[model samples]
Target: MNARDPQLPLQPDEASQIGAFAQAMWDEHIVPELTHYIAIPAKSPMFDADWEKNGHIDTVLRRAAQWVEQQKVAGLTLEVIRAPGRTPVIFFEIPATKAGSTDTVLLYGHLDKQPEFSGWRSDLGPWTPKYEDGKLYGRGGADDGYAVYAALTAILALDRQGIPRPRCVGLIETCEESGSFDLPLYIEQLGKRLGNVSLVVCLDSGAGDYDRLWLTTSLRGNVTGTLKVEVLTEGIHSGDNSGVAPSSFRIMRQLLDRLEDAKSGHLLPTDFHCEIPPERVVQAQTTADILGEEVYKRMPWACGGDGGPVLPVTTDPLQVLLNRTWRPTLSVTGVDGMPSISNAGNVLRPFTAFKLSLRLPPLVDGNEAALKLKALLEDNAPYNARVSFVPDGRAGAYGATGWNTPDIAPWLSGALESASQTHFGTPVGYIGQGGTIPLMGMLQKGFPKAQMMVCGVLGPKSNAHGPNEFLHVPYGKRLTAAVAQVIAAHP
Candidate 1:
């Protein structure tokens, strides 16, 4: 009956209470605030060129801080710390009443979101929250916005049952979508205020299923930049320039060919790839088996008009998983100098530019990858037309392949399983997310000994950063209870 027992999972009554509390918190508080949050258009600093001027980032931050303060958790200390010229961080501390507890658990999340992408459902948009089928549909809800709320709610759930936990710190940043460029400074400034961390729980990751808790063990890094190609000083009539002037768009495509296979989507440059660890391959195979067709089916294949029914490069689920999580890939996210179809004229454009986003393997050196990409693209410029490849916002990959899963994961795995079974009648799942959270790599370096548990509600069909983005309300509630159980049993 001891609430402090480290060897036990939560009892049925305790789990039920936690779940109910989490549900109520989501329904009554988080969902409402999240709706307002979605409305703010709090794009990351990179996307919001006039972020400070627009005041949307500040507005969302203040709103979040206000909501956290209103929670009125006993012994809670909340602060909005601002380093000049950086997005503000929302820091919260919840004290533990355990007799001799000294360790602190750092829970990480972000408030800044990706820019509003095109192609939302007619009934849904990025900034408008819609409640449907137990999902809170909005841009940031599932991707993040729920982290601090969930973290605090979990603690409150435990407190309601008088269960003891490690002291908790909720560190929510506002620049994750922009590769978390500002986080290192905040971590350094906080110094000892962050305390001796024994566990780092991150809620900004992907889930394998809505029916189970998924733990992310690895994250790919990001290398992003712009590639520009110029052919002429000004546009000319297509008939006059036909077959004479090289199309800048065509030159751009040729430059991209130096990096990736035009047909297979493979990174042609050997330097862009790294040796995939055997353990990761094994883990991927097992996870693929667990997910089966859910691996691909979960995606909203033709959401709106953005993408079609594209077949994966491989039919083997394991290969697809490994390709996504442990390989290098390139995406041309945005383009410039291309006229809209509606505005198109019979003119050959003078220049073309593209935003290149490359996802790196977990152990690959992102800086090196960027340098190599720049060299490859700039080396043999097609037509020797003015070409430039500028690299920006490089984040090194995070790999825990050689590192042992800390003592805390087993306890959390058990908690996740029990919670999942109770809530969804399914076993918990483990995955390595293809997306990057630079904070994990930063925290790993800062807290070398800290046990890490990365979980999230961004399961398939959540479509984060895309149209119809949503938070699975039920799974979120279950995840909240699972977090409470882990904290209750943390050694």
Candidate 2:
């Protein structure tokens, strides 16, 4: 069969063929591969410090590369690139089937997983693969383990129908969960090999719901660090020090007070905030109308003392969406210098340490915000108690910056609409994600003219980082087909 023209729109029959092929591929090949992938705890370098030594990252990388090689896609070339003291990346390229096309479509994903968080169902676990009711439940499978498989499947689906596509390249990195700290080095080394990137298909984002295709319009930046306060050299009897020495925990509170409003959960530093774009605000309102109260109701809130569900900060869907996507927030993820409640005693602890994670608005510079955060927490110490804030070195000196996508080209936008309507029976939806993806900002700067299609399968309740994380297999299949349709229509 002769390859179709790249400039042409995909016919209904071609789209159907792509969808069918994607569905069959997911059932026959991708699901089993993801099942094995979920079993391996290929944690990111940040969570697993000895990632290289542990070899889990390498195992997943090698396995994914082997799978790609086994596919035997025509004109495809693959390589597993590694650098000293960095996680490995699987880079693959397939020449354009369309004549005289130099534009490249970069498909991006990550193999690394977050640390195993608690609270799985009794019958499920982070490492135990369970495929029930069209959902693949486990770590990494949805968060991103399915990406490499889905990407290749999309291209193969197009090829199987002789639908023409531009040059396609895959960059599957193992350090994305670690803020993609090592990606800069690899990007620099690859340089011209990346070609003239005209489009990027990032599968490491989230979907608003499983009903339609969702495009991540923006991403929040992240700054994480440890804040420690010391008031004594050793533990002292509470009776002896309660009235005399300052409490380390109290000092810790005072330090954090300068950064956040305990009563309102708002970050006090104005520098951390940005003026939300008018377009994004309008989009948020539209999304709020579509999602309604599901925006806040989706959170797993705990019960209160009154036997009612603990309320969220707000119930307005617009505010909820804006707060998560465009607002800066502070979270104390971990604590130290305190004994467990079961082992508690009448001792005054020597120090208090908190692992602080700060989410910055899309326009805020993360590197500068990180530096400001270090200063805010360490500058003033009550009672001369020692205080310090050390940013996470794993993210490098320049912290992870948020991304605001460039304006969508008309052709690409039309393609998204067609793909969504064809595959999902709905139009494409746009929403900003609260999570950070460091690569998006880097790619925007590197390829200023590229159109980014950042979408994924982490729909409501899929829970990417938390326990009981799952990939909605039905959504994944549809999403893969949508990707192929869009690529075939790329010009």
Which tens-of-lDDT digit does each residue in 441-477 have in candidate 1?
7787788888888889988788888888989888888
lDDT of 1 at 151: 86
Highest TM-score against the true fold, candidate? 2
- What candidate 2 gets wrong by more than 4 Å, as runs, is 394-398
Q: How well does model 2 score by local distance difference test?
A: 0.92
- Position 326, candidate 1: lDDT: 81
RMSD of each: 3.2, 1.2
lDDT of 2 by residue, 168-223 (tens): 99999998887888898999998999999999999999999899999999999999
Name the weakest run of 10 consecutive residues (lDDT summed) in model 1: 397-406
Error of 1 at 190 (Å): 0.7
